[model samples]
Every structure is written in structure tokens, then in C-alpha cells.
Target: MIGDTPPEASPSPDASVSTGEKTGADVASAHKPSQPQSTESHAKHAGFWALALGSIGVVFGDIGTSPLYAFKEALHAAAGDGVTRPEILGVVSLALWAMILVVTVKYVGFIMRADNKGEGGVLSLMALAQQAIGKRTAVVFTLGIIGAALFYGDAVITPAMSVLSAVEGLRTIPALENSISNELVLMIAGVMLIGLFAFQSHGTAKVGLLFGPICAVWFASMAALGIGQFIANPQILASINPYYAVKFLSEHGMAGFIVLGAVFLTVTGAEALTADMGHFGRWPIQAAWLFFVLPCLTLNYLGQGALALTVLDASQAAGRPFEEMNWFFEMAPLALRLPLVLLAGMATVVASQAVITGAFSLTQQAIQLGLLPRLNVKRTSETQEGQIFVPQLNTMLLVGVLVVMVTFQTSSALAHAYGLAVTGTMVVTTMMAAIVMRQMWKWGWPRVLAFIVPFMILDLSFLSANMLRFFSGGWLPVLIGACLFTIMATWVRGSGILFEKSRRDSVLLTDLIDMLKARPPHRVPGTAIFLTSDSEVAPVALMHNLKHNKILHEKNIILTVDTRNIPRVHESERITIEKLDEDFKRVTVHYGFMESPNLPKAMGICRKQGLKFDIMATSFFLGRRSVVASATSGMPLWQDRLFIFLMRNATNPTEFFHIPPGRVVELGTQVSV
Candidate 1:
């Protein structure tokens, strides 16, 4: 697991297709001179409101479910021997203002404007920053990997936390409140979460239609319940003032700081607004938040505070100490508690879907950027390219979710770990965003600091607060993030060294072509498309064929695939061909990092370019390397073994590149790393 979308899902759209969709990056890109020009908006422009509505479900689900536990956990943490009214006000103030400053201002107002072409996400922004700097610097790469690594932690925890909190609501039902066992709650949550992951392979197109309406209703229900509580205790509205939040933190000492970690949960899913910017565009997510989602969430937290105060007054009148309670579920009138819990479960499920899909999108970007090994990617939807299922990622997420759920037991315990990963990612995002603004937007130091400092302060404050609870549970995400970072860093470094070594030992393509022309071998009839990472060098497979079989194809195409910094590559810019000789040609195919490559589709462009192409008549030659650890390798023994393990587990080139397996010829070579 890594981040929450529409709680943490990335709606990775195409980089090839340009549109005037008013995405976050579009506004920011205006300051940069070299950005791609925008064309007319999509045909779905008529459904502007509809897209906004759908974004509510997919983009804000994770955060929308926060009221289920955020306030309650804050109250629990703030309770020093006993619950107090000021603490209640402080908790509400923190929750509301955290959203306003962190989610509304930093993300929606400023950061969303920092997108890659029309795309937005940790990786998209990372790539955009690289484009800004004119090269991939160590700073941008480190931040990207760190942000992405923390996302997996968020991915694992989101489902566990959201589902657990929703199912935990069952204890508030009158009939079950007295009888429901903790084991039963855990079992129900475990089953539902496992089922959610299982259903992912089937794709969400049909069921996703219901997401908007369901989430819309969930928010409406929350708003209505909150309004009732508001009417009963309108005084709670004062908590929206930032002064109370400031006062609480300043006066309450370490207790308040500990509670701050709990309060950060309110904005845990804020990253989704930026992550899914590509999917729904800037205006829709912004519109959804500014008009609808923000108001509903603010009201709900207010209502929870109001309701908690009411319970407190009643308890004080009864001459008993005021006790912390599950104010979210209890806010429902006794008769509707069960229905509310059911809707909560539905909302949580929907949110979890976003988080999981975010994981898939993040992994896709990671692989495209060469930070990860190629996993088995299966497109679940024929019409929609973004709807993909990664089998390995899915299994990893499911296992991580289950393990987290079992270990945390309740959402309250799990809450400590959630904000750490989310905030760490937020800090990383802010740092990268600063670089993008400085370099891409050409912001001066004073301007960059002025614009980015406040957001950095907020992110770091929350991250530091979460760190206070390291032993309690905050260490989990940190541990997970560190491990992921190591893997990514190792993979990147090892792959770089391997590529350099391979290039050093490989024969030059021009030299090979010249030699072949001088002394031609037995000629074959059809085309031989030899795929390699570097087209400047002759492919190992081609060299093997010439050395062993002592033959050459009549038409040999040296094919190379390169991933672009953009989301998708347009057909016109998909390929380039150079006729090195009558018998040999160099073909280069370009794809956006967000795209899955299909060699056949790329070759289709070759036919239109006066090159004869036939899939049936062509033999695809791929180099298969069996890497063994070497004592003199660039990396240590452990890292060498780890990279080899990753390479061994990487998906087959034919499958990864979407080539026909039938016409593929694998030439194996032993390589030392």
C-alpha cells in the first residue's frame, strides 16, 4: 500500500492527448515557456458537472471517511486523565484548520497547479521537475523515490484503517453494541477488505458507476447528521477559528502535540486531490472540494465536536466523569445507527478502492521511470487504458493490509501509523514542489521560500508530531518506507551500472552494419526486429544469431523502446526510422511513462512510414540475461543478490512490452553485475 486516492488513487491520463481541462499543472505550467500547448477540451465537456460528481467518489473517499475516527482518536489522545471542553474545541479546531490549510490551501489552491503537462501525482511531479531542471538530478530522484516509498505504507494502512474504522462502527448499533465482540469486528473487516482486493481483478467500470451516487449520499447523510448536531450546539462553530488550534497546541504541552498527530489524520487523504488531478482535471476536484466535500467534512467535524460536548454536559450533569466516545457513529439517532454504519462501510469500501488503484498507478509510474522491476500488468478494461491490474502489487497490498489489520487490531491504534506515511509523503511532495516552482516556474529564492515555506512548516510539523509516536505505531510506515526506498535505490543504481557495463562490452550498431555489408551471411527471407535498450549498440541477440546461426535476415530492424517523461505518446510522435543500409534499419519507439508499450502498435506506424511490416513474417529477437553476482561488481554482495532477485522476478519482455509470444526468439546470455 502507498497513498489514498480520490483517497490515494492516481487517475493517470494520457500525455499524448492535450486538452484545455484546467488541470492543476496547466495553471502552473503557464509560468513555464516550454510546456506542451493545450488543445480543445474533451467531448465529455458536456459532463463537466458529472465529472466533478464522479471525482467526489474517487478523489475524496479516503478523507471523507476520516470523520469516522479522526475526531474520536484526537479526543482520546488529548484526554489527560479526563476529557475537557477546551481540549474538545482544540481537537475540532485542529481537524477543521488542518483541512483548510493543508488540503484546501496547500493542495487545492497551490500544489495542484504544479502538474506534469495535465498529469499530477508524486511521479508525474517528479518527472516534471526533472523536465524543469533539464536533467534528472539526484535531489528530484531521491524525493520521488521517498514519496513513492511512503505511498506503499499509506496504501497498506488506508484499507486497514478505513475499513476497520467503518466496521468498528458496528459497536455503536444498539442491538449489537452490547453483544458484538472485538474478534467479530476484526473478522468482518478482514473478510470485507480481502473481498475488496479479490474483486479488483474484475475491473470497476460497472460498479464504479455507483461510486459517485453512493459517496454523494454518504456525504449528504454526514452533512444532515452534522446539521442536527449543529442546531443542538451551535457554539461548536467557534472551533473553526484558527486561534483555538494555535492556542491548544501552545498551551497543552506534549499532550497537545501527541493529539496533533491524531488531528493530522483529518487531512491524510488530501494528497489524492493532487494525485487524481489528471483523471478528473483541476477544476472538478477543486470544485468538488471547495463547494461540496470541504463543506460536508467541515460540518461533520463540527457536528462531532458539538455532539461530544453535548455528551459531556449530560455526563457532568449526571455527576460522572466525561468519557471519550465514538462520536461519529453515536451522532446518528439510535434508530438510524445501523443504516449509518452500513453506509459508512460502503464509503470505506469505495475509499479503499481509490487507495488500491492509486497503488497500481504509482507502481506503473515507478516501473516506467525505471525505479522498480517490471511487474505483470494486466489491463482490466479494454476501452480505458488507465484501468489496470498488477498481480504482484495486488498480492503485496492484500498481504500488507491483512498484516496491518491484524497487528493494529483497531483503527485508533492504526491511526498512529497513518499520518506518518501521509505526512512524510506530503513533506517529500512539498520539497519537490518547491524545486519545480523554482526551476520550472522560474521562481526566485525569496518567492519560492515565501510560497513554499508555510506548506513545508505544516507538513514537517505533522511529520514531527507523528514521529513522537514512533514506538507506539508510527514506526511501521517509516520501516516500510525505508525498506522500499532501499529496494528502489538499489534497483536504480544496479541497473545503471549494468547498462553502463553492457554498453561498454557491446559492439557498435554502425560497425556491425558495415561488417555485415562487407561479408554478408546466409540471408533469411523475412524481417528480424531485434529489440534492445540501446539502439546505438548492436543487440546481443542479433550478435548471437550472426555468430552461432551464421545467418542474417533480408530486412533487419534494430528496435529500441524509450520511455518519455510524459503520460502518453501521440501516434505521430510514436516512432522514428533511419535506413542504415538496404538490409538494416534503426527504429526507435517512444512511450510516455504512464503508457504500456505494445511493439505491434508501434510497428504499425512503421508501415505508414514506407517500411514493409508483417507481424506473422517477423521474428522478435529479445536478449535474456542470467545475472550472477560478482565480487568486483559496483554494488555489495547483498545488493547484487537483491538486484538479481528483482531481475529474476521481472516479467518477461514479451509480456511487459505486449509483443506476440509466438513470434518471439529469446537469446540467453550470462552477465555479471
Candidate 2:
């Protein structure tokens, strides 16, 4: 589906063909019926606590590391007017409520319930909405693409900002301050990022074992440090009241509004929780968030607030500047500062890992949905199908991250670029979730509005605040997101036009069969399988073969593969076979968007349904279209050119479907779109 060709279309001419032969016994042995294999066993044995622990590592990594800079940046944003007690309390209260409202209530309480066949994310939600509406509306599709694009924008900024912020902790150490420069920190962070991406190809199966316990330790340390500070100044707990946030925003005017942009950093990674719902079930993520992540983050932020108040009072009394202080690192005991820095660094790396892998997963989904060009996706873990590596994506992310680090140079500067992407994504998520509530849940208008109106206001408010930063490095994500949106839109539009053109050019399957019967071509001994996109039409390869080779096989099969919107197709419903005539069969195979198609294995399943296959005697016929852009095509000239370029580079069907090269025979033809 990632390729330009439709799922039922023949392979491109560039696809490799196999001429290898397998005897009847070999084919029979290769496809022998065995005990039914169940794909649902992976999560069956995982208890609530086990899954919760796993969720802590993967789902909470990004949000958990926010304590590294969220408070610091928010305070810095307010420091220009000389930090006030009301401002500190108000900012902390705003952050606390943002987390409570945006994440706990909106996503955990509502949106997560809208999973598409146990899958959750923008695309999954889009699919659910489309299914409920009985058709794909342009609005829903565009929202999904925009959300996905913004996620990539967020993905690039996350590693650079998180890692830079964590490593910046070293600047707090007096012993290292003189020796560690910003360049050295950037170099170190760059190396860690390089190493992190380089290891993606190896799969996370081995190291993933340590993510849970390590994050557990990280969270425990956060709570301990925060609790130490909170106990020292118990009054800081009063900031939990919404009144402070209201009073601060009311009194400070534009400055307070602008500070909300920085305050948004507290919940930057909330989307990751929903994005990863399919990996760990909803309850596990919810339990982890409510029990461990939420409390730790709350305590840490409160502790940071308490520490900031003390630092502010002391600085005011001493007539010194509070601008130079890095309260996140300063909250730790002086003796443990270096170790804390190392811990924070490791946690940020874990956060980076989560975001990086999330980008990979999202890209795959987009490809399956026909929203992007094909890239070589390598399954890194044999047991963990979700663990995949996209080499092109990795290189692109690495380059983007490095550029961000080099250009921004510091976490404070990069933070200005970070919130826009997250806020934009949050806004889109709220919008899509609203549609789901109204249309899919079939909720009454009053109930839907009651639930979504408040969340929309909250998300839009955050988005508006983030817009204050558009010129201050926020444009970076917007630029990246816009470009990605264009590419996806162009591909989807072009693919649709091309599909229509192919349909118009194709001959009807019945007519082709009838013509073959009337002509009575030189009968060949082998079985011939023609891959096609439309079952209603005969494949171009079949017609081309008859015209050139002047022969027809003893038996013929037309195969079409359908990628469903669901996460996975059940084995029982995978293959559908119909005997069109004594010499011909129409076989359709259904796969989930989350799955990769395998022709041989699918054919093996058909063996039980009276379909016989002898690899040595069977020949595969594939149509490879050499697409050319034409002025009369429905799409604009630029889009037509882009489509042609994408088609030229698409992964050949031979490799994509895992078809045997030696048994493949490709027929080439040129088509103008």
C-alpha cells in the first residue's frame, strides 16, 4: 500500500521475477497444514502490574523527563518582570491543571475509549470516524494527516530539546562549569543521539528489558527529591487550587498569557500515551499514569515550585539576580548533583527512544493507509512485530535533530520551538476526538458538546498561547509540518487519480476470460497467477502475455490483496477463494493495516480450500506500469511529476509481498497520468 500501485494492482516492471522450480512434494511440504497459531497470546499472560510497569517505560518516558526543563523555562519566562510569589503559584497551578485536564481527563478518560479495534492514535481515530460516517470525508482525512505531520515535527524537536536540557544539568556543577562549554555539551548530546539511532536496527528486545526498571528508578528519584523540597515548604501545595492560575492570568495580562506557552511543556508528551495505547492496553497506561507517573510529576513540579519560591525570596532579599539559577538541577543535593545529571541524561535518552520508535510506527501506519511513499521497513524483532526500523526515516530524523541542536544551541532557545508542535497536535487531537464523540459514540448533541466544548477551549487556549512564539523558533515545526502535509496530500491525491486511470484502461475480467476461451491459445502445462488491483478487471500482464507469448496456462488465478483498516485480520478470514470457471479462480486475501503481506504463506492457506499449488509448474504474471506525467491528468503538473517520481522509487512488489523472484514474470507498459 505504501507503493504507488494499489493493493490489487500488478507489481511494477522493476519488480524482480523468480524462475526457480519446486516439485509437487516440495510445494506440498512447504505448505503442509499445521496446528492453528494464535496471535493473541502475547498480551494474554501480561497481568495488570506487568503491563503498567511496561507502560511506565514506553508511554511515560517523554512526559516523565519534562521535569528537566518545564519549570525552569516557565520561571525564566516570568523572571523578566522580577519573579513574584503570585506568579510562581499561578504558573505551577496552571501546569498542574493542564496535566489534569488535558491528559487525565481528555485523553485517558475519553479519547482512549475511542480506539479502533484496540488501536489508538490520530489515524486510528480517523479510521473509526470514517467507518462510522460510512465514508472518508475530506475534513477527517486532512485532520489525520495534519496531526501525523505535527507529530513528526514534535518527534524531531523532542530528542534535541530533552537531551540538551538534561545534559545542561552539568552546567550547574561548579567543578564542571569552567570546563564544560555549550559546544562540548552539544557534541556529547549528538553522540548519544547517533548511538541511539544506530542501535534501532538491532531492535529494542534486549535493552527494552531495562527501560521499565530504569524509569521506575527515575520516577522514584523524582518523587524523593520533590518530596524533600515539598516538606521543607509545605505551603507550596496550595498552588493546586485553580484560583492561583486564574488570578495570575487575570493580573499579569499578556506576560501571563505568553508564559502559558512555556507552561505547556509540562504536558508535552501526553500524546505519546494515546499513540502507544495499542502497545500497552488502556488500563495499563491509565494505571501507570494515575499511580506512578502522575504522582511523581506532580510532586516534582510542586517541589520545583517550592524550591523556586525559596530561591526567589533569597535572591530578592540579597538583591541578586535569579535569572542565572537552574532550579531543576539545584533541587538536588550538591553532593548528588553530578549523579543526578547522569540520571536525567539517561532518562532523556529513554524519552528520545520512545519518540523515535513512535515516529517509525506512525510512518508505517501512514504508509499502509496510502498517505506516504514507500520506504524500506525492516522488522527488527521477530517476536515483536511492532518493533521496526525505517532507514530513511532514521537518517532524516538524525539530520533534523542535529540541525535543531546546532541552530538553537541551548535548551532555552530550543524550548521556544518545541511547544508549537505539541500544542498543534493537541488541538488537532481534541478536534478529531470531538468528531468521534458526536458521530461514532452517537452521543446526544448536548452530551457531546458538554464533554468536548471545555476541552476544545482548553486546547485552543494552549495553541493560541503557543502562537505567541511562532516567530521565536516556533516556525520550525510549522514549516516541517507544512512540508510533510503537502507531500502526503499530493501522494493521496495522485494515487487516487492514477487508480481511476488504471481502472479506465483495464479490460473486464469476464471479457478477458471469454476471449481466451474463444481464441483457445496454445495451452501451457503450468498454472499462471496474475496479480491485480481490481478484481473486476483482467490484469494488464495477462493480456500482454497472451499478445506476446501467444499462450495461456492450463490453470489461471487472479489474486487481489486488501488492506483493511483494522489492526489485523483473523486467520480464519484471511483468504477468500471463488472458482470463476473450470480453468480460472479469483482469490482475495485480506490483511490488517498493521500487517505485511506474504503471497506464499497466503497461498498455503488456500491449499486447504481445494486450491493446489506446485511452485515449479506455476508462473506469476505481474504488470509493471511506467508512469508518465501528462498535462491532461486530473492533478496539477507538479503533483503529477511528484507522483511519477514516487512511483519510480516505490518498493517493487516482488520484495514487498515476499514473492519468489525466480517464479515471477513481469510485463511492462507505459501509462500517462
Candidate 3:
């Protein structure tokens, strides 16, 4: 079992875990990888509740904050002329049941069990599916890319939407409602979101402990709010029946379908459940959702519906218009409403933090798997394996979020775009997961069909419902995802072509060793390590050094760093050494996709095996390539240019690998891809 999961692959020397070959320098990252507990018994462990509490802060934060705008938006959408009692019941029922089926049944019950070696996430699922198939298929690879692209879309919108929705809750306070203008609210949310993003670099280890208790209060307050309304109307509990959801949908034709899109807001962050399973473990997340989170969310929605029902009846009697307010914020009493706003704001910030962290983790996984170019990855915490931050991603996400917030201007408008990426991601996850169930879990065809078909239908229905808003703002996620997918596809295609070109241009390591032995070059004193993707072929840097300098080091190492399909590699299995000749040795270092590739720390492990990797006495040789666009490249000319752009912007290997610059030498080469 590995530590944390995020994504995965590459080949030749790169082909071990998920995909095929990445360049040697791409192996480095900012910090040493931390050891993660592989024990799958978190539920039985002493840290069970602590893990569950952490899950509340980091995992469910996204979905937990949904109540702020979900019912308000759904009710408004379905309320063509006015909200009827039946519509209230229906919207509440739909929201409740969607969470039950999607989050509870699909994710908690089934998807969590499909984890790849104790890791979860769409990419991890892709790796697991590839493992089950005994080879990586185009279908699995495409699905993984689509899911990850959609996630990036989600990552951008979640922060904007959550914060905006929570800040809008200030309108519920009588004192602040009249004082705060819509523009003022946007500015406030903007500042808050910027602050949250700014805080990301500091690492959440210290304050992360507080997340559990805060969310616990948030959930408890939601439950209390619901129960308070239940005192006035106990019959609202009847919305729990599926009959209301089905009946409401059957009666309201187009409007009900449109409401389905808005109802999806309830489960928008459901992916976090599966994505973060590795952080808190499967059991704690499940237990938290099934027991505390589910009940609180269900009750809150019921309370909102009940309050709406009361308002409807009072309006009908008075002959006035039935107004639909932000019922989540209104559920609290007048004096406590401001405090509720403060609490909601805190919860929303926490939600945004979770999505941001997820993005960083996803970036790390994508880079390790060769799906994306290497970025400046920094470790935020020494203790936690999942606490790294990617500066490129952080900046991109912050910009995207601010732009989205400004463009949409309201949580209501942002809601239109929110569900599209999330639903598409769910659909892709559902497909990939079904395959894993059939092949890996060995589920019968009938069982698999029964398990997956309903989810597919539901997800597709949600996706189509969201399509109605495509012209409005729904196209935002679709556009963002498309751009990201193009970039990833281009990178993969470009890297593969470049690797092929290198393989053809390179000499065989075995033959080179034999030739050198027949007529050995002038030997230097210290050890020299040349990183390569293929151990069979001589590294470009090694060849360049020998040809240009006309000398060789006394001791040489052909270092091949592998990112395994799993999340974390055990230290015992981290480094493998094979003696190639008197002067040369082959060293292979293995890391999980979720881990940072700290070469020095990994190499230090070799001392246990009678091979000492002396950092002070070693020289690191890196092959730096200038990738120019070629018309004959496998990718189009435009794509070739895009790949070159990405490569040029990627983090330098000396910094990325945490190698000392003074001890490193880079050999330059040109390649067309």
C-alpha cells in the first residue's frame, strides 16, 4: 500500500508503474518524500476519530458548504412563477437523494473500495484499471485525462463559487443586509479568496487540526437550524421519501429538468470523498459521511424546504408574492444570523482550501506521470506526504478564480458553470470505475451493469440538464477543460515523439561499456551520476562528457528514477543497484506518483546496500534539450510549438531535483518533436 493518491506513467527506463518514458531531469522535486502509513486499518487504529475529523476539514469541506446556495438556487430555478409546496418538497427531496445516491452509495459504498493500493482519485483509478487490464489502454488514458481536466475546471470555480455564496449570506443580516452592496460583497469575497490562496504556501499542518472542530460546529449548527424549523413543521421530514423527488420531476416537465442541474450543486464536491481517501483513509471518510455529514445536510435541506413552505402559505393568504431568500442563511435567528454568516464564511474558506490543496496534489501526480510538464513544486510540510504546493498551479488557479468571480459576479451566475465540469468528471469516473469493478473486483456482468448503469444515467441526466445553461455560463468549464485536455494531449504526444527520436539517436550502454573497456578514457577522481530514461542506452550527458572532455570519472552511475503506479514506494524497495562494470554501476530509484523525487535522500538509502552515494564527492550530469517545433513531428506544428513553450517554462532540474547547482553540469542538445 502507498501513502496519498493524486494521478499517474511513462516508459523504456520510465516504464514501471503507470505510463512510459520521462526524461532524467523530470525526476527531481523540492523535498524528500515522507513515509506514509500503509496500514489499511485506519478505522481500527488509534487515530480513527482524528482521521475522521481531518476528513471533515479537508475532504468534505467542498460539499459541506453547498447548503449556502444549493437550495436557494434550486428553488429559484424551479420557481417559474412561484414556489409551490410540492416543488419545495421535490427540490429538497432531489437534493437529499442526490447526496444519498452519489455521495453515499456510489462514492462511499463502492468507489472508495476501488482504490489503487490504498490511494484514490481518477488517475489512481486509471492506474488500477490499467493494472487490471495488464496494459494501459487508450480508453483508460483518455478517461483519466478528461477527468483530470474537468477537475482543474472544478478547482478554478470552487473557490470563487463557495466564497461568493458564503459572503452573499451577509444579506440575511438586517444590519448588514442594507449596508452591503452587491459590488461591496464581491470585493469582500475577492479579498477573502485572495487571502486564502495567499495562505496556501504556509502549509495547513498547524491550522488543519482546527478544521475538524470548526466543521464539526458548522455541521452541528446546520443540524440545529434544521431541528429548529422542524419544531414549527415536523411534516417537513416527509421530504426524505423518494416519492417526493420522483413525483416533483414527473409533474414539472422542463423546469424540473432544469432544477436537476441546480440540484447537482448539493453534490458538487462529492469527488473529494474519493479523491482524498488516501489522506484520511477510506473508513473515516465513509463513517463521517454516513453518520454526521449526511444527517446534517439532509436536515438542513429539509429545514430550508419547510421554511419555504411556510412562506408560501403565508404569501397565499396575504395575496403577496412568495419570496425565495437564501434559506440556508435565513434558517438562523435574527441576532445569530451575523454569526452564522461569519461561520459560513469560515466554512466556505475551508472548502476553497480543500479544492486548492487537491489541485496541488493533482499537479504533482500529473508531473510524475508525465501527463504535464514539471512545475516549481515546494514541500509545505516535512511530516505529511500530501502537503506540497505547486507555484505555477497556485498562480494559475488564483487568476482563474478571480476572473471567474468577476465575470460571473454572483454565486447564482457562477452556479451555472459549476456543475458542468463536476458532472463530466463524475461521468468519466463512473465509466472507469465500472471497468475496474468488472475486471479487478471480478464483479459479474449483471452486478456491474446494475451498479453502474443507474449512475451513468443519473450523471448523464445531470450533464444534459446543465447543457441548458451552456450559453449562459456553463460553457466556462467546458472551455477550460478543453484547453487543459489539449495541453495534456499535446505534452503526452510531444514527449513520446521526442523519446522515440532520442532512442534512435542514442548509442547502446552495453556496447559503449564494452568499447570503453577495450580503450579506456582518462579517469577522474570522484563519482559522476548521469540520469537517463533508458538504462540500456548511453545517456546523452554521459556521451557528451566523454566526447568533449575526453575523460571519464573513476566511478560512474547510470541513475534511472522511476515513478511507480502506486502512491509511495517502501524504502526497502526504493533503490536497486546493479554492478555494470568496475567503473560503472546502474542505480534505479523508485517513487510513488504522490511523492516528490528527492534524489539525494533516495540515493542516501543505497549506503545500506554497501554502495555509498556520497553527495559531497559526486557530480550530477543532466541532459538539457532544446525542443524546437518540427512540421514532421507526430503532433501538429501548433501543438509542437505549445509543447516547446511548456518545456521552456518547466522548472529547472537542479532546483526541481534539490541537487546542488555547484556540483551539477548540464549538457545541451537540440531535438525536434
Candidate 4:
């Protein structure tokens, strides 16, 4: 059985919310510091379905469907074209150990303990590294981002392989022998993938309800299947001995490395457990895994081996055990075989959903961090607070997945492309976990080294194993992910450089006010509030107001709104208004990243708090870098161009921020990073 799930930490910071912090000359200095609270306070609200279904539905996908091929491939690597009973048993034993050590022990038991504020994901970990390690944060941050990008590649492959393998069961079913073809099976998977995305806008609240029970039963059935087989061939139970696993490894020698790819699949969803920690809490997932999942997985893996021994005479069955095995299907009633296939297919769909959701969350964080251009984001379910759908991303992923499915066509072919992306992600997670253990958890050196050493050996083994497939097709996803990562890094760096360069020419508010006093004060009729991108740059519109109109408004408000990841803010944390004398106020609004900033709502909030915003006041601000460009300095040539391309297509913030279109004036500044 997969070992006990590792203990995990809970932190609540979804990357989807844009909460940029700014620094500079014209911008007001100082921000309300994020206060530390009991991490437990950020638990899931009323939408248990979102948590339950999403956690089970989205998070369990990759790992859940892993059993389809993990053992099969492992055996093939060990015994070549044919496997003996002993070899099959040994391979299953090795696979069980890999799952236990990598998934259950490393991730569920240990890595989960590193959540940031109840939100657990790569970026949240990166944020922790920033607070604890300072400049070194970027290194880990980059690695984590690369991991996240690689996840996108995994997402592309999971659905392709899982669905195909499940449909391949058609080859096993006697009735569909003539009707099913590889093209037909692939087309079915492609249609299912498309339909899956099409339904995303409607949200998963409805189908999600079925996911847990369905998957629970699916795991139970696999365990049942394995247990029944084991009862018949009890001798195979000896494979669970650690001696079998160690013996297989030492005896196999160099050949063992290739098995790492297959082994990696067993632990694919480890990160998801941590990523979904905010939804289900630490205990439920752990409980579900330890008591329910582990036993079932172990039982099923053993059963597969037990069944393999009956027909294939272990030595000749290594390359394709299922093709040689009669017991796996023959032992089951015909009526139940199709059900198992359906269950496997559904499990694969769930796995794909989890990766898709992760992608959405990651994209949101990239935008907020200025690493990515803004996109139109919609919350899919009212009840499921974290349920979100991105239309553009949805279409893009759908197309990418379809192209891959069509091109690869078979699960075995797609397998060549699978492990590299997930392995890279695993490596990145370990590196970040090491940072968290040392810095945030304040673990001693011995404890930190103990955790990372074994994990690194395992992770690198998979990475190296996957490298064998790079030229064969594995390079596709890595290349795609790396290119995508470069685009994000470039845009972020470019924007930062532009923001910095603008500060030199900007005037300070206090100094600007002094300059206004020396000139004749001709007043505009009403108050004017200027929106700014940076805390350091002065609003160019304010300067425009001075030079052209020769006057400042009767009341001027310098407003900076910061969106943070916490769900809700305390009343004391809402609006901080500092008087600057002569009807001028510097207003800073702190919004939970999950909450949208409504100008009208916020204006009313200010009204209730005694900060007067004259109804007639029109906001004037310089909106800098409305478009991102690839200046050679910040990002590479292609990335700068790509950033510009994405920026040009991005939705204008004017509509997104809920500002009055006509009343708000936009002053654009060109920026190249």
C-alpha cells in the first residue's frame, strides 16, 4: 500500500487574486502590515461540496489514475519483453515502496506541513521563502514557477493517457472487439475533454457531488478486486516484504533507473493534497488516504501481480503483463468489467480537472505578481468560493490537449511524454520544501537534511529516467513550459524596470503641494482622486492639472488599493486615511484578494468612516504600463515581444476595476523591462 500521507501545513493565498504592492516617489509610503493570525481561522466556510468535490475531484486525479500504468511499466523495465512471476511480484513491490516513500511519506506526511496561511501551492511556498530567506527567495521562486509551468504539461498528458488507457479496456471486452479502434477511442477521449471544458463555465458544483462517492467506490472496487485475487493466490502476498523491494533494486542495478518514471506516477498527486489543503483541512485528506486509499492501492497492485503470475509465467510476461494475464479480467464477471473501465475513465477526468484548476490558480498568482498579463476571470460557483474558470486559458488548454491526444493517439505513446513534467515539478517542490522546513518551520539542520536527502535522491532519479524520453517526445512539454516561464519572468522584470525608471522623473506629493502654493491656485470645481500603479511615481495627471489649469482641486485624494490573499479583512484593517492638511488625504484601502474592490462600495465604506469623497469628484491617475513591452533589458527578445502580444490582448483594467469610464482619465507611460 502507499504509505501514510505526509502531514501537511495550511496556508491561504490563492495566486488568482491580484494584490500588487508598490514603492516609489509620488506614491504614498507605508502599508498596513499583514497581521499574523491562527492559521486555522481560514478554514473552508459553508461550501463543503467545493472543498469535498474539489479536493477529491480536482486534487486526486493524477495520483488516482496512476495505477493504470505504474505497475505495468515498472515490470516492463525490469524483465524486458517477458516477466517471470517473481519479477512481476518484485516490480509491484518496488512500485508500492515508491508510492509509500515518495507520495505518502514525503508529500502527505512532510511537505504538507509547509502551507502558507492555509493556502498551499508553489507560489505560497515561494512567498514563505521570500519572508524567510530574502534574496535567495528568487531562486526557489523560479524553481517553483518552473514546476508550476511543467504542471501545465502534465495536465496536457494526464487526460490523454488516462482516458486512452481506460478506453483500451475495450480491447479486453469481447463485445466491443470489432467496434473499437484506436482512432475511435482517441476521438472519444478528445470529445470528453472538450465537453469537460465546455461545462467548466457552468461550474462543477453539480457533478462534483458525485466525484467523491464515485472515486471512493472506484478505489474500494480496486481493493476488492485485488483482495479477491490475493485470496486465490495468497503466495503473492510475500511481495510486500521489504526484502523483495530491496532485492529487486540491488539485483536490477542500472535497469532500476528507467522504472523511476513509472514509480513517479504513483505519487503524482502528492502536491495536490497540499494544494487542496485549504479546502479539506489536514486531517480529512490524511484520514482518507491512510485508512481508505493506501490499503486499496496496495491490495490492487498486489492483485495485478497475482493475476499476472497465473497465465504469463512471469519471465515471458514483463513487456506487456496485461496482454499475458487471463486472471485480471477472467476472474471478474463480464458485467463488472465495463463498470471498472467506466470508473477508471471517471477517475482520469477528475485528475484532469485538478490540474486545470491548479493552472487557473497559478495564472491568477502570475497576474497579481506582475509576471503575467491580466485576463478575464469568472467565479464559477456561488457556493464554491474557490471555483473559478478562465475562458481564454480554457480554450488554449483544450486545444493543446486535443492536439497532443491526436498526435500521440495511444497511452503507450503518450507515456513517452508524461514523466518529465511531473518529475521536474517534484524536484522543484522538494527544493522549496527544504526552504520551508529550515526557515518557516525552524526545523534543526539534522531534520531538514534528513527530509531532503532521501527526497532528492528519489526526485533526481525520476528526472534522469524521464530524460531518456526527451528526444522520443518528452521534450515537448518541458520546452513548452520553459518558454511559458520565460514569458512570465520577462513581463514581470520588464514592468519592474519601467516602474523604477519612471520614479526618477516623478515629483513627491508634499513637494508638489509646495510647488502649487508658489503658483496661483485656480481650483477645479470638484475633488479629484488619482489612481496609481506604483507607490513611488507621482500621478502625471496631477502635474497636468498644475501646468495646464494652474490649480489644484478643492479636495485631492491620493488613492492606492492593494489586494491581498486573505478571504476577509477586519474593520480596523479596511481604510487607512491620513490627513495631509488643506483638504488633501492619502487613502489606502486593504482588500482581501478574494474580494473584489467596488469603487462605489469602497466609497460608501469611506463615507461611513467619515472620509468625505465629494460625489462630483472625478478620479485622475496615470495608468502606467497598460501594455507590457519586451525591452531587451528585462526579458529576452522573444519574451518581450510575447509580453507585448499578451498585453495588447488583455482586458482593460478600466472595466475590471469598476471605475466610471468617462469620469476617469487615463495617462499612459511606456515601460520596457
Instruction: Give the TM-score of each candidate.
Output: 0.94, 0.93, 0.93, 0.86
* Residue range 315-361, candidate 4, lDDT tens digits: 44465443543233444568788877778788878778777877777
Residue 409 error for model 1, in Å?
A: 0.9
- Clash number by candidate, in order: 18, 12, 9, 41
Candidate number achieving the greatest TM-score relative to the actual structure = 1
TM-score of 1: 0.94
Cα lDDT listed for each candidate: 0.85, 0.83, 0.85, 0.68
Sort by lDDT, best first: what order? 1, 3, 2, 4
Q: Which ten residues in a row have the lowest lDDT in candidate 2?
A: 9-18
User: Considering only N, C-alpha and C atoms within 3 Å, which residue pairs clash in candidate 3?
Assistant: 9-19, 9-369, 10-19, 10-20, 10-21, 11-15, 11-20, 11-21, 17-565
Cα lDDT tens digits, model 1, 302-406, are: 999999989889999999988777999888988999989999999999999999999999999888788998888888899877799999999989999999899
Return the number of clashes found in candidate 3.
Answer: 9
- In the range 1-673, model 3's lDDT, one tens digit per residue, is 0111122243223222222222212243223265233433342354667788889988989999999988999999998878778788889999999998898888887788887656788888877777677666789989999999999999999999999998898888888879989899899999998898888889888878888899999999999998888778877778889999999999998988999999999999999988897787777788889889999988888888888888888999999999878898888989999889899989988899999999988888888877888788999888888888887788889999999999999999999999999999999999988988888678899999998889999999999999998988999999999999999988887777777788899999999999999999999888999987777789889999999999999889998877777777778788989999888899988887788888878777877788865678899998888878888647889998998898888888778777788999899889888
Distance from true location, Cα of 358 in model 4, Å: 1.8
Over 4 Å off, model 3:
1-46, 612-614
What is the Cα-based lDDT of residue 493 in candidate 1? 85
**Model 2: CA > 4 A from native:** 1-46
Determine the C-alpha RMSD for candidate 2 after optimal superposition of all C-alphas. Answer: 7.5
User: For model 3, how big is the CA root-mean-square deviation?
Assistant: 6.3
